[model samples]
Target chain A: MPTAVTPSVLTRPDDEPTAAALIAAAVETMAVHGYHGTSVRDVAAAAGTSPAVLYHHFESKQRLLVTLLDRGLDVLIAATEEALDLAGDDPAERLGAVVGAHVGVHLESQRESLIGQSEIRSLEPAGRALVVTKRDVQQRTFERVVRDGVRRTVFTTATPDDTARFVSAACTSVAGWYRPGGPLDGPTVIARYRAIALDAVGYRP
Target chain B: MPTAVTPSVLTRPDDEPTAAALIAAAVETMAVHGYHGTSVRDVAAAAGTSPAVLYHHFESKQRLLVTLLDRGLDVLIAATEEALDLAGDDPAERLGAVVGAHVGVHLESQRESLIGQSEIRSLEPAGRALVVTKRDVQQRTFERVVRDGVRRTVFTTATPDDTARFVSAACTSVAGWYRPGGPLDGPTVIARYRAIALDAVGYRP
Candidate 1:
């Protein structure tokens, strides 16, 4: 079950490159095919490598799965942080910009988000808990944005946390149904999603 | 792979006694182990039954999984319908009710919802297509509600489809990290989600 954790430049400092590739591959395959339907070979095939390559990169099939969860969350956090940077001096504009950025990143990494969401349970309990904790941080970040808006009296909301969650969920689920060549591209989706988020939470520009 | 399709029931159709028990058991096992990770034997073991009984009831594992989806959708639809049944014909009231119901069902059946949301790929191509189509229908239903709300001037500004999706994803993801005996129970979660939906969409009561 022991597999290598080979580090790569494309991955986070602690992440192995092969492990990250395996994860990126797993994200594509697992989202398209359920985790159960996918095999170690599928991850290898997608990476233009073999199962030994995957093992050489990670600790075990389970650990590789866990690594993906960890990295996906990391990517999501990084993405969310970037989105938050879009926040401006004005609360509503900041909210809209932030939400747009959030949705933008979601569609940008559609495969990764979809797989992380759908296959989270494939990880061991510890991994599952870690993912949940990271997700909470993401949720809290949204809540903070909404709370700031409310305090400014620019956006009127009864429950900021609930509103934050609505924005979060709507933005995340775009990965599931959005087609690459559809009438709505990622930009359009982000724009529309931002409108929805701002209006839902009553952020007046 | 042969499985029985228990369509009619003497009891309330929503609570399919044996099927509920089976799906409930399957949801827990499937979410963790995954559709591939879980076997009928595992489901039966979790449910305190024999695999023979499961096969006799469901015919095949895939069939059972589909049944779970069918049940979860039924509950979700019913909740939405119930929410739509607001008095005084106020679109805002109806919208809030609908949001509440949507979140309620999602939070209540978090496990089953998660299973259906994640394991959808395990279905045959045709089955998966059917599920996608059904999901679209659900989306359209919410869109119509948003449209009505907008027409009634209950909302400040938003596209119906995007707003509908915003509401939908908000509640749907409650299953992802919602722990039993967590700080927020079903009612609180539903109410909070409802508030979020209302604010996001600009529902004025």
Candidate 2:
């Protein structure tokens, strides 16, 4: 049987230090230069390693990007799941928690969020499928919360799916324009987005 | 006197067909390979022209990108202005119109919208400044309507600016995932977003 590809939110014990270094370098380089503009040599040089070492760890640059995207998604999914766990069964609170976590993650990991959004087109079929599967899980998390809210009559939106997507899209966009020390701090942005998500869903309370 | 740059919604008579062809080619190429990955040679080859001819019209690849970004903004700004004109003075109607036009533009000009959103970072100081100025105008357009709505007590949101930003972000994101022959058509998506924008602002009937 083929080994399963399970993503871990935390740093894995099996992760080689050199491979981790390469992934970090790849994120930074690809964030600036984009996938097509970034070469394996660029990532290897940034990681202070040789192309042979990079190839030893990962088959190619595409594989490196897939790993980066997977790791980013893992972090996001873990954070969201934690938030949902802490929030009680109240649909409004759950919606708030989910949007807050989404905004916080995007703000804290802006580069990774940006790369995940922009570089999906650069991935091959298998890699794209992997990322899309993770993405759908994230999307469905929001949908489930919104649907629950609708079921409980706490949310009044006619289209629960569309509302969930709008909230997700709005939160995802923060990474594109937010600056760490800009006008609004992270907490303020998070709070605002949480409220906006509620408003988008037409929270009755 | 320095020639003041004015952006037009319609193609200008001064627009050389060769230059237009080059810009079209640049959008398609950069959409696929990105700005950093694409060279003047690639754009020239795509346009079926020589690098000498490309340079004759555009001083550099960066200038060509700026022109493309500027033109894209022009089209968006014009479409939005027309929508607002037809919306009358009612805040809710105006909000619906603006978002409808916004989603419509992103759907109709997916390549240009995607390029404009992604390639802003690739621009140099002057080019970035120019695009940012146009973008602020677009942003302020949404802000004004929201502010007006709040003043009239039709929208209950305390943070009109943030609500405006959220609505704009949500609408702008349509370009990233919307497919022509997907489950939802253009009119459906546009109407759904218009309603979502209203819901986001806490619009009152």
lDDT of 1 by residue, A1-205 (tens): 1143222222555555556667667666666676777888987887667999888887566777676667666777776677667556777766766677667666776666767787776666888798789888877888888889988887777777767776787788887777889888777887787777777677755
- Please write out the lDDT profile of model 1 over residues B2-61, one tens digit for every residue: 133223211244654665566667766776677887989998877667899889878899
Superposed model 2: Cα runs more than 4 Å off: A1-14, B1-14
Clash number by candidate, in order: 10, 0
**What DockQ class does candidate 1 belong to?**
medium
lDDT (CA) per prediction: 0.71, 0.86
Report the C-alpha lDDT of model 2 over B1-205, residue by residue, as the tens digit. Answer: 0112122232456788777677778877888788988999998887778899999999999999899898888888999999998988889999988898889999988878888888887899999999999999999999999999999999988889988999999899889889999999999999899888888999987
Compute each candidate's TM-score over C-alphas: 0.85, 0.92
Listed per candidate, the RMSD to the true structure in angstroms reads 5.2, 5.9
The lDDT leader among the candidates is: 2
Q: What share of the true interface contacts does each candidate keep?
A: 0.91, 0.61
Report the lDDT tens digits of candidate 2 across residue range A1-205. 0112122232356788677677777777888888887999998888788899999999999898899888888888999999999999999999989999999899988888888888887889999999999999999999999999999999999999998999999998899889988899999999888887888999997
Interface RMSD for candidates 1 onward, in order: 1.7, 1.0
> What are the candidates' individual DockQ scores?
0.64, 0.64
Which 10-residue span in candidate 1 chain B carries the lowest summed lDDT? B1-10
What stretches of model 1 exceed 4 Å from their correct place? A1-21, B1-21
